[model samples]
Target: MGQPVMVKPTFEKLIPTIGSSFRCFDRTGLNLPSRWHRHPEIELTYVDRGTGTRLVGDNIDSYRDHDLVLIGSDLPHTWQSDQYLGRKYDRHSAIVIQFHPDFLGEQFFELPEFEAISMMLTSARRGLWFPAEVGEQIGAVMTRMTIEPPVLRLIHLLEVLSELSSCPSAEPLSSQGFAPSLTSASETRTEKVCHYISQHFRNPNLSHEELASHACMNPSAFSRFFKQSTGKTLTEYLNELRIGLACRLLMDSDMSILDVSLEAGFANVSYFNRRFRESRGMTPREYRRRYTEATETSNT
Candidate 1:
């Protein structure tokens, strides 16, 4: 019954246009709190600026300016921007497109010539990462889509997907177990559990019993089921979740070590320090100093 993570959307009030059930947005001047949320539509995102880590399903990777990614339906993801990269209003721009599988119609994909695209879509279940060059090329098309006519937009999308399917350097970003699915009772419970943990990572009072209750399951059953689903022990996963939050805080906020310890959910400063060192192979202060120095050097 480790705490659950809640996935919140950055933009909620702005809905897309009619006839275009799919939506696209350019996110700037904002940052996301880490959580896992999903929808039934596939997502394509291109980051024009900023640097941080991206978590798609169970895969975690460092992302720099100009990262392009495609996430399949129901794949959980978050784009975490570091503090240094968040200094300017327009410095973190991203192009995000969301569309259903049948948006182009079922018959479009069934055509013999679309076999590669079909395969690519199937493979997209695990998420996809494009090389910088490919990203740049695909990103150009996405940018064009903002101004193109309906018919031309479809053509551009087809070209982009074709290129993606043929690109040799593209890699899968999510773990092998990262299966795509519509939200169900079990999935909702899992999502709730993940969200709670993410939000309360710094709260020492949080426990498995409390989490199990949130999911409406017995403590023993919840513990066993969570482990089976995530491939990690309840405590271990919670610690990792805490550490992940701590890492983000360390890089994004000026909060001191003691404050970070409490904010990330360790009961005591000493235990937080010990676990931080054990999990990251360096002291909290040391990790921050090194990471900051490295970022500064890169910028300079």
Candidate 2:
């Protein structure tokens, strides 16, 4: 098999090219997948308007307008925007800052005054999420960054980080399982497997043999490795993926339960009904009805 294609974030597209040093600025109206990429530079992102899901390492979470997050170096991550909101709301209107720890030299973080900032950086290796109020404050600072010079922008960026470090409510997104590993090849291979699964969840023909072949591993090894890495077996993971898609289709499409199940990759109605109930704790028809009723209530 060919070597897996691992995606990494490219800094070439940002406004005012960041050097091999610490930098800060605003990036407005951006919509692009960074892919399964990583870099040496740590990133802080604050979104202004959007609703989507974020995949940071192995953790998946739903995000909406005003979501602010910080990610560490060489940890795989991506954001997928909701298809319906793509045109109505700008997907990537936000502020982004990237900086290397060495930008301030090796001794800067060792100082007593910088201890909290240092800890924050270390904690961020697993990713961090700022609370709503703090996110708003960070978003405001990021908005101002677009108008400031490099020097002032960097200063304000430090202030922002300082404030974030002190916030008692800041939530860590990923834990030890999501920490960055030094092997790029392994990371890329893992991402390849995940992307493949995401794209093909609706295909009933998808099998363990095919996925293992795609990852260039034998079936048993791939099964073991995948479970160890993701904390879920291939069968369980694929079912969850399919059920997630089914849930969305149930809410958005007018298809019947049997058709929805068949479309979502189940072999037959009985099996689909059984699996759907197991995964969601409810029948597909009931889920769809409740979801539609809830949406109607919220709109009114």
Index of the highest-lDDT prediction:
1
Q: TM-score for each prediction?
A: 0.68, 0.71
Per-residue alpha-carbon lDDT of model 1 for 175-237, expressed as tens digits? 687453333555556666765665565578888898888878999999887765454557876
Q: Which residue runs of candidate 1 sit more than 4 Å off their true CA positions?
A: 1-22, 27-36, 47-55, 59-67, 77-94, 105-116, 131-137, 166-169, 179-183, 228-233, 250-263, 267-297
Count of backbone collisions in candidate 2? 2
What is the overall TM-score of model 1 with all chains considered together? 0.68
RMSD of 2: 5.1
Quote the lDDT for 24 in model 2.
60
